[model samples]
Target: MPANAVTQIPAAPADEAVRHFEAELRFETDCWDTHEALSQQADPGFVLLDVRSAELYAQGHVPGALNLPRRKIIASRMRQQYPAGTLFVTYCAGPHCNGAARAAAALARLGYPVKLMAGGITGWLDEGFPLERDAAL
Candidate 1:
């Protein structure tokens, strides 16, 4: 380290930061509306997935949601079940859990149209949406 040599660590400019923030905000807004609309529509094109463990899923989950645990998302069997081109909406127990994100990422990588249900199952339940016990495949 030389005192005379000044090293500048590049930081994102205010404008750039704002642009990034706006992009993220737009994405969040879009996802929120999409989730809400999908819930109301209950269309088969939109598949709600419970990305938690089987035990957690059995406890409670979104009505008509498929129990596709995050751990099994990358597995061949689960991949076959979900397949590519399917519109997947994934959720975990709550916001703190990254299981939904992981599941979404895995599905995205596999070429599925995936969206992470913001706020997870907690949000769904809080919205007064119905939940079911032990969803059938």
Candidate 2:
């Protein structure tokens, strides 16, 4: 492997690749769009779940996110609380963190509808969205 050489492992057909990439892109954009809508209170169709710690959530969080730490999510808990088929958006600190993935995975395993917000709070902040906090903040 030469330092200046380019190594190509494999590639999908251009059209196939385009469609796959577009779908992936759509997933990300759709998550953001859903967040934007929820933040604006336009529709209450879904839930934004903050998979971070209580402290983190207290400091700041997405406007309408519900704090349900990654470790605490369980099928029984969800069943006892929320309805059976609720749409949920799980988010964490940001791209650097995996809390959202952890939470989403748990929810998925329990047959819950869940989407991981691409960038988490960092992404929201980057998009210039203000954080909602407890009265202390």
**For model 1, how does the per-residue alpha-carbon lDDT over 24-108 read when each residue is reduced to its tens digit?**
6532323345456766685757677888988888888777778988777775775667566778878888788898889888877
| Candidate lDDT values, in order | 0.74, 0.81
Tens digit of lDDT per residue, candidate 2, span 1-137?
Answer: 54433445556889999999887753343446856678577666777899899999999988878899989998789999889788788889989998888898898888887777888888888877788999986
Instruction: Report the Cα lDDT for candidate 2.
Output: 0.81
Off by over 4 Å in 1: 1-44, 135-137
Query: TM-score, each model?
Result: 0.67, 0.82
Separate clash counts for every candidate: 0, 0
